[model samples]
Target: MSDAEGSNEITTIENPYAYLERDFSSENFKIEVKNLPKFYGMNEFRKLLNEKLKLHSNKIKTTRKNSPYAFVCFRNEEDRENAINVLTNYKWKGYDLQILKAKPAPDPLVKKRKENAEDLHSNKKTKTEEVCSQEEKLKNSTIPYHNVEYDQQLKLKLEDIKKVLKKFGSELSRQNTELKNWIEKQKFLYDGLPCELLDIRFSDTTEGYRNKCEFTVGIDEDTNLPTVGFRIGSYVKGTTAVGPVDNLVHIPESMKVAVKIFQDYVRSSDLKVFDPEHHTGHFRQLMARSAQNQLMLVVGIHPQDLTDDQLSEFKTSIVEYFSVGKGTPAKVTSLYFQKIVKKNHRDDIVPTEHLWGDTHIYETIMGLKFKISPEAFFQINTKGAELLYKAAIELAEPSENATVLDVCCGTGTIGLCFANKCSQVLGIEVIPQAIVDAKENATLNSIENSDFFVGKAEDILGNICFKATGEDVIAVVDPPRAGLQKRAIFQIRKIPKINKVVYVSCNPMAALQNFVDFGRPESKKVHGVPLVPTKAVAVDMFPYTKHCELVICFERWDKISSKQLQSEELVS
Candidate 1:
């Protein structure tokens, strides 16, 4: 008798078709079950199917930890079809099972056995292979450190920075100066750290700290519906499937709410979600930024093959829905529609059109009100950015007689922060719009000691460096994750008046070569004397993620070495 037909006392029952040979390798015999609840174990899952639903499967394969999908192999196509019909939309453990016919792939245990067999005859795998294996294990994960504890995550990030610094130290040692000895001594004393490492500073709140989030518009893997969320994996990894952001811990609830409302709006709209592979459809990405309970939503769309009137109607519908319709609950202060078209030429640029509400969002950091445009580069974490800037300023130690040269300054946040402590603040940025915001921010704060300039730092740094009034100049270089360009680094080194540079990097690993360039000996390509790193500290800007802001202090070593010699002589 079937499990459902038999009494509860019959715990074990032999399959009536045990004598019948079956081909489990065929696709008809396999069913993929998605949206598996995390609370259920393998044994519980088997019991739920065999006893609760009276479904029999020859083999069941569960995914690794934290994965939400599994596979079940039945004896025949008839049983597989029955299992799929019974399990689809079946509620268990608070999740409705999304069942689909799964394609045949090598089983995990069988694949492992084959790999082990091959390894017996082959030598040990290379380090690159091992790293690739580890990366493959996390290919399905969006947030790499979501499962790791917060404290342990911070330690891992600190170790990452130390490794980068050690590489920098090794390159610096080749210069064969007194700095080399200093680096060696520091490495010996501090366990591979090039300088004194301070305790990491944490954000005020770790959970839901992100003020800015960019969600993709695509098909969700679990529901197979057009969803607004982050991608499950990168496009390079052959997975463009989007997953809901309700599970991500870094996004603030305000942003999540906006995403939900927008998702509903898009699902009801006639337009289709943008397909990155085909470059078709209308909706592309949704960017939400929140501050003080106010949200700024930028709807990204690929206007492909739509007429002017159709586009206008689409825009009107969105504005009306966000203004008076269902999106009213989101408290959207700024609404923007961005036409996301790829560049056809080198100078081509697509500007975001402001639809309704405010044009800029206001964020108050360190008691200063700064205007953030749709495309402006602002820190994702507000409170954590305050800590990062504080560490940078402390490392800089700008005196009242000093001038702060904020290189690659975004919206003048860093420059204005230093304006109160220094005599003058000259901010240089590449984007003209950001410079406009920066100037307005300087005026908004009502501080006259700061000024913002537009143009690339390499082209404008020399012109702006001589405009400083103070005797001492401190350069604060906070470039993008790609780090400062080679020419920009050369410009900073060429500026003899700038005695100290406080480098704030969100990606220290990518900025390794930039640091090496700064400390390298003077050459034709890299002019001026080399700068030596004195101290460095880390600020935990993004919690539950493998990212942090690194603030490093670089000063003219000739002067520092002279002072050290004088102190040593006095001590002797």
Candidate 2:
């Protein structure tokens, strides 16, 4: 009797495959089953399957940990067929099991070689076709000015910006009501601009503007060499192979040279390149940070049972090769060696040891000196950040008697910039190291008006008490991509004295949600007050990407009423 047909009282069945069919396809000797419980080991699963099907398989291959599938190969087609016929829709550990014939796994090297050959052919064909098409178009067209193409490109970029703004519910100013009405009448431009809109500023330097790059260390598929570059796919996708990046337009020449040097050193050394699958090997990643003419290199490694002397030798070789010298291609100001064990290891938890030179690099933004630590967050594009900060400050418009509160202030760059104009600047950040760096930066610039605290803004901002001097308070919040917490928004609303708020957001979609929490009257309110968004501007901080830095100005409605009352009293 079949396992399912047998009575519950009968623990052992005489014939397990009595109801299963013996006619199995000759081609399908491998049975693949999915939705296997993650906690079940290979041996236990194999034993259980054999007991139910009354069939034995020599090979049972399980995928990586937490993978919900396993492949079982039978000696004969009949056994495989019987197993599938009986156990195809079987339930295992409360999950419906899906069984199919497994295909042969592709060879990575062969697949890579074929892809490269096809890419070469495709590139050649595309180039030839483009050349012929361009020549034909030039000969046939009456007007061949390059300005026409430039104008088209500009229009496309503007359309993209408008699409993002619409997604975030951004509205055009009332002053452009005529334009808005015209846009509404036309079907083609109906969704392009809403009744309210935002102003966008273009970037000065469009290419090679990235100041920081994190590269993975692995073997290149094309060249079969140890390379330091970006991964072709993620670990979850099962394609952790990395490709060499020799001419990435986003990074500067100095960074590229530094990457090449590190790649060469890793190739020549006895150290093994990290493989994300097995999680073995020595070298894992290389993070390069550039500011002005100096470079800071942080090397991540998995020191697998290495001696102290061996580690010392490795560090010495890195220092001797990449350190600043007469013949070096890049000026490496700081070198850090970080030991990482897990794929998702936190930088704060896993300490980074300073190997050579200075521990921090100095970057000047808006005439203020800021110290950047290894793990501290700083804007990638320094020049673009200058424009972003300027927009934030202008929107804030802090008076001489105003006190500026900078939230999520990484290294206190924004707060220090406001120190020259405001009476006092208070900065808060969650990262402890970032707070330390911010304090040091304030001291470096000799700006004593700024005070930085280290904690989550939502938890700490509520308990902190402001001075009783009755100074006008303006908050400049520059949150990360995930945006601010709702409690943080509540705390901001609780502060009745705060009048104007300048919100600098790297991710506009998330920021829009925060605005809803603070602006909508139907939603939760703090102290029965809501903020109204007045003005907004978008600065292109990340060029050649779909991301932009957005700054929005919000004012308390009650404060505006109080200001109007004071103005009437002054007139009387």
Candidate 3:
């Protein structure tokens, strides 16, 4: 169920079939019972389900994000799952369905459970306790010692590590060894920013990596400081460069081997690897890649091969991202050969998308390109995205005359989904390339009533010249990992005509923080204050992984009063 759909009081269900019999058409809602078992054939299943639905007024409101179990609200629990018998070994949809006789409302303790889940140390102590026990045994045990003072020495080493991390601007909370074991890093970045010569920065030790490692530095032909696996960077900050994302900083051995293999394989007499200047080859490669990719998309031919289109495509298709090969210069043109090979580096961390081949990017109804960057956000699962869009549409059944604002509109997906159902749609984003792609996608879709702008949502949104009143406007925001920036939330909180907000986020922590920012009592969030959500549902986007996407709908309790708006700061 949606988090905020606190209908601790669901009393009615409106059946669409009855409405259709009364002359209205059943259009938006439909259901399909999946892969039912042979025992309860479709006929019996349908009959049984129909009887169950009848008790619930012939309607079953689904749980938030289409959870696995149906949140069927029967008048009484006794009849909800009265299978032929409790002992009957029957299955539906190829899976056993367990009917839970749950309280009408979720456990009041759920809020507390969520809080407990937030604590990192609740489960951390087990590891820490283990570490302590190991240390104690180290000094007392009689096992032969290559180093009898290993425990003391390790403690000193850990202290040194603390100093190193501190130098690099990191504060490390003591790792609980009792609950865990060996520690190591694949590589760390200076300034915590990824560098021309930076590598992975890991936490607790995992398979394949149980100790510290080192790297050897060398210049490649292109001369860009390829942060190859030769030498591992340290977590100590200010050592070279600093960055915001610094938790990981160790280069794994696989990366080193990969780098060596790449250097050795391309330099054979039969193959020519391009070797440009020493200082700027990497940056040039970076630039050339961007420009060449843009060109490639436009003409569908990469610049690596000056050969005929088919030949060139074939040649570049294999190692395009691994490494660049020397280009052959012809009378009329030049070709560069760089073979980018795919290899596993620091096991857990490696670039996954588009590195090997073409990635299928989603498009808006208007055909704008949803420009996805190597590191940028794109919905990973496909079928899941369609379901999410449908849910959003149901929430925003836009009338023909409505105006919709799509904020942080990645690839312009949301706006395009609503384009045909609305009069005017506007999308806002900060990435220039993504905006360009979004525009392209819009044009591709042949959607005529849409426009997009590039900038922070709050700043650009407040300045949009279009008049918003008298227009049925709905604002849909799908933000990044960090969730909606405070300024954007404040702006959204004060939107004049938009009375509803569909807040989508990949991070629940940030989402909750943003919600508090808008709905909390003292933050001048009065306009945002009314966004008491009617529902919040979590979608399992990453099956087998912990990550989940949350969709929250907040309906305004009241429109912005004069006092809330008069002194409200304009979004930055």
Candidate 4:
């Protein structure tokens, strides 16, 4: 496709869905295919892989790595070599072949070694033993270095420390399995887990390990996705609400083992695995699978081991995979070479809108572009989000004159979704980029009755609605995993004339309980009236993940608006 340049010198090009549908075949070996433009979300790569697998023999497998560059694998080195040659020789997807000896898979005997090492459990402390003081900011402090020698010495220590830590950490992780199982065993003997959480999965990283689990207990009175601002919804990012722990509850041991097996399976797929934040590989699949937008294909590379140039190459290849437009024919370029030979490279992604011609709209259900950013929250499943919005609107029961508040509006999909049906919508978000995108999105859709504000929900919601309709105010809040802030809940409980609230929570497990706590007997009152929770619907936004989204409706059981909760809110 002849690409047109944008004002910013970013190129806009035709969509590559046509090329994606053409006949393609996988080289039977794990050859490294280099230098093609990636599609948004890496669909182009997936489409190519899918097309090749369909047209070619299934005996050979084409895989990707955590770096997300193509790595075709065969049953043996010979087939692998053959596949490598074909890929290197061909001009597929406008890129040239550059296959070489990728890091080989760890020997199968290593599995035996890992298993035997599990027996040395009581003798060593795992790296998980060195827990940072806090969860969010885990550290003593970042030490400043005066010289290159300091860096060299620390780098050496880092390797030794990593090895020792991983060894013991593995032991600790095994113990975690035992401990988690012991808890679950108690639950199985009885009816279920003693605590409200439904299930737990064990995961370990070089840094530490996390006990990922689900909770049955949920936020109270959550209904549909709240429409709190012009382009807003609810989702909490951090987890500060660690409740009191009760060890008396039983945990399931056998289930944990089975789950561990499943976890291992998920880690072996075509989806590349790595932490974009830490630049290390971690088996974060459990959480990744929870959202509709998250898709996991396991590649055999551990995230922590890729070299700097490899990382750059991986990022470029992955970015091309994530893009969806016609790729400029790949020739050896300074850019690709720099990626192929770099150190401490920071470039890992492309502004997808720029790469995909900026013409491709990130449309939600309403066909309005979503102001999605890398950091801003968007529904995990791009398509499934439509259903969620549709469901939220159904419960909001909007009229032409209804005023809507879309809180936690990451890119404003929910608010813009309901704008055509409502009188006006106000969207709120903490991300400046999101607010900018949300406003642009409204303009792009030519919708005038909506505007997005840049601020946290608790701070701006009161003033955003103060001058507006005291009645017919419908709030749709989709908070992050940590759930709503205490202040936001209080405001929801007491918002005068705002009797209807639709809560769309993705982290229904941990976050939902917060709402339940807020609406508990001791919670604040409406104008002299106490609040109550009303349950609604559970929508499976992610088909594969254990997590699900919930929409609940909260109506004032008492005659008071949340003005009564103001004193309690102030105390909090």
Q: Which candidate has the top score in lDDT?
A: 1
* Runs with alpha carbons beyond 4 Å of true place in candidate 2: 1-161, 164-198, 324-327, 347-349, 463-465, 522-526, 559-572
- Stretches > 4 Å off in candidate 1: 1-140, 175-178, 343-349
The whole-model lDDT of each prediction reads: 0.81, 0.70, 0.42, 0.45
Q: What is the C-alpha RMSD of each candidate to the true structure, in Å?
A: 18.1, 14.5, 31.5, 25.7
- From the highest lDDT down, the ranking of the candidates is 1, 2, 4, 3
- Residue 528, model 3: lDDT of 40
Error of 3 at 13 (Å): 69
Ten contiguous residues minimizing lDDT sum, candidate 1: 11-20
What is the per-residue lDDT of model 1 for residues 99-136, given as tens digits with 9 covering 90 to 100? 99987653333344345545655965633245433223
TM, every model: 0.75, 0.68, 0.40, 0.42
Residues 203-276 of candidate 3 have per-residue lDDT tens digits of 12222221122222223312433322221212111011111111122222333233344334333323232211
Evaluated at residue 566, the lDDT of candidate 2 is 92
Clashing pairs in 2: 171-196, 171-197, 172-196, 172-197
Model 4 gets an lDDT of 0.45
Clash count for candidate 4 is 80
Candidate 1 CA-lDDT value: 0.81
